[model samples]
Target: MNENQKLALVTGANKGIGRAAADQLAALGMTVLIGARDARRGEEAAAAVRAEGGDAYAIVLDVTDPATIEEAARWIEGSYGRLDVLINNAGITGSGRVSPAEAIDQIPSTVDLDMVRAVFETNVFGVIAVTNAMLPLLRRSPAPRIVNVSSGGGSLAIASDPDGPFTGLPTSAAYSPSKTALNALTVQYANELRKEGFLINAAAPGYVATDINNHSGFLTPAQGATVLVRLATLDADGPTAGFFSADGPVPW
Candidate 1:
């Protein structure tokens, strides 16, 4: 509430990795805004953070809803005056599975153009919309950070290499491509905002257990959110326009 208090916004934070990221950021003394499409879930997540003695608030933010995005920006502008961190964690798996054996041709070969478009609508365009809408407020902070939640499956270096880990993995025309675009967008935005001292980077949380994969992952949501939180709270010297994971830099 005070000018000195740092404010952060984490989208799709009703549960899973987003919620964990919000919790970690709040624990670090940030006034976190839990952005969820469902108002009830958002408030519940915020309450959970409060129970942990963290400063948090709920805001209805359906990434695909332009009206809600505008409303959220207005609310932050009026209430916080400035935003120190923006975590674009809202994402969908599109129409594919990440299993190792699932082949590229097995997926809906026709690749629902609509599904691909819809995936980009949320995973790609939504990020751009939300970031552009909040750029003004982000500029108000002396130190600003933007963390785009991306995935290893989006790594072109791995996808293109014959000997790479992901080379033999299944592919989806939707999800993977959308995330690749997201990584590129992250780089472009970070480059543009570098002079403003805004640390913008894309992070892959590794394969985490969540509904997206039917809980097939080895890691937990907490583990996934750790890298995200680290990027969210980076110092001025932290890397920008880069792609990373828990272990180290992920091929971009």
Candidate 2:
């Protein structure tokens, strides 16, 4: 391992946008840790990146599982001694791949409380767990960055607008609101760590073709990953506590 090389960890990197972000970071010469709940899938994803001549490794990490999270942190601390970038990409939509008509499950008034809790567990609480666990290692680096993968669906400004593009999309209390909470959490974290030089921000990857949406989205995974990669690789003077997309700053 080159002492000067940076280490980046992308949670839930076995497939979709997470995998694409990992691949991009590896291509940029940063050693990327592919975090997946399934060990075999994680290894396969890492192998795919390694085949492309990038330094990548597989780490079994289920963000909702405290044991795996702690173990991952311990392994990273022992092996790399420090972490430069942390991308909280692991999340669940609660209801998988629902079409517009099927989005009734997420309707706020009749939504299941259990479903909402489960979504928050992974999308919100999970980020807090992983970020806090990795903070010690992140602090050891000269330039540390944290990118919380959010969604444009979480934008209240956009969602509330009757004329907005997302107005046609089905209302989602579970998935969309979870992301909004995640955005709030990101801002709080950024405020707490600003003086320490940590650039923590939220990234809203526009509707992309992935398992979460059953490949119904128009944008490719690589396209959705652009903002995540950009924010993760920001310079010291870059903005923090902001929500951004591939084009520019998104409404809060």
Candidate 3:
């Protein structure tokens, strides 16, 4: 590996927006690692990128699995000695949770507790696990960055506004709150690392056609991945602790 080349890892990158971001980053000349819970799927995604002439590879990484997180960290240390970018893109919608193909009905009024746990396991807690594990490697980079893929549904400002785009969204005590927690995490990390020259921020990929939404979205995965890639590749003077979309800053 070239000493000047940057290394980026994207968890849950086997498909959808995660895969799109990984491929975009690789095209920009960074060595991108496709992190996934399933090894075979991860390898397939990486191979797809390689076939497209990008430097990419698969590494099994189930973000909710502590052992796998630790092992992934160790692998990075032994192989690259440092990490330039860490994108916590792995997340679950908890969609189709209660009723089949339901979103608005996953309300907080009487949502299932077990369902909430499962959502947080992957969305909120999983991000924490992966970010914490990769921090040491990130510290060693001359230019370190962390991008958390969030959603507009996680925006309280929008949710509370009667005229807001997300006003019709469900209470989503599970999936939505988990992402809200992630946005909070992004702020905390960005503030903590601000003085250390690190840029940590969150990106809200607009509703995109993906498995998470059962491909019901109108936007393509590539379109949704734009802001994520932007945040991941922010310049040294770019804003941190900010929530943004392709259109602009998202109301926190």
Q: Which candidate is the best by TM-score?
A: 2
Q: In order, what lDDT does every prediction score?
A: 0.89, 0.94, 0.88
User: 1-252 in candidate 3: lDDT tens per residue?
Assistant: 589888999999999999999989999999999999999999999999999989998999998899999999999999999999999999886665422236665678887888889889998889989999999999999889999998887888987899987555456778878878889999999999999889999999887888766687888989988998998899999999999999999998
By lDDT: ranked, best first: 2, 1, 3
Cα lDDT, model 2, residue 225? 96
Model 1 lDDT at residue 189? 100
Candidate 3: stretches off by over 4 Å: 96-101
Best by lDDT: 2
TM-score of 2: 0.98
Predicted candidate 2 versus true structure: per-residue lDDT over 1-252, tens digit per residue: 699999999999999999999999999999999999999999999999999999999999999999999999999999999999999999988888534445778988898999999999999999999999999999999999999999888889998999987667678889889889999999999999999999999998888889877798889999999999999999999999999999999998
When 1 and 2 are scored with lDDT, the better candidate is: 2
> Positional deviation of 247 in candidate 2, in angstroms?
0.3
Instruction: Select the stronger candidate by lDDT from 2 and 3.
Output: 2
TM-score of each: 0.95, 0.98, 0.96
The alpha-carbon deviation from the true structure for residue 182 of candidate 3, after best TM-score superposition, in angstroms, is: 0.9
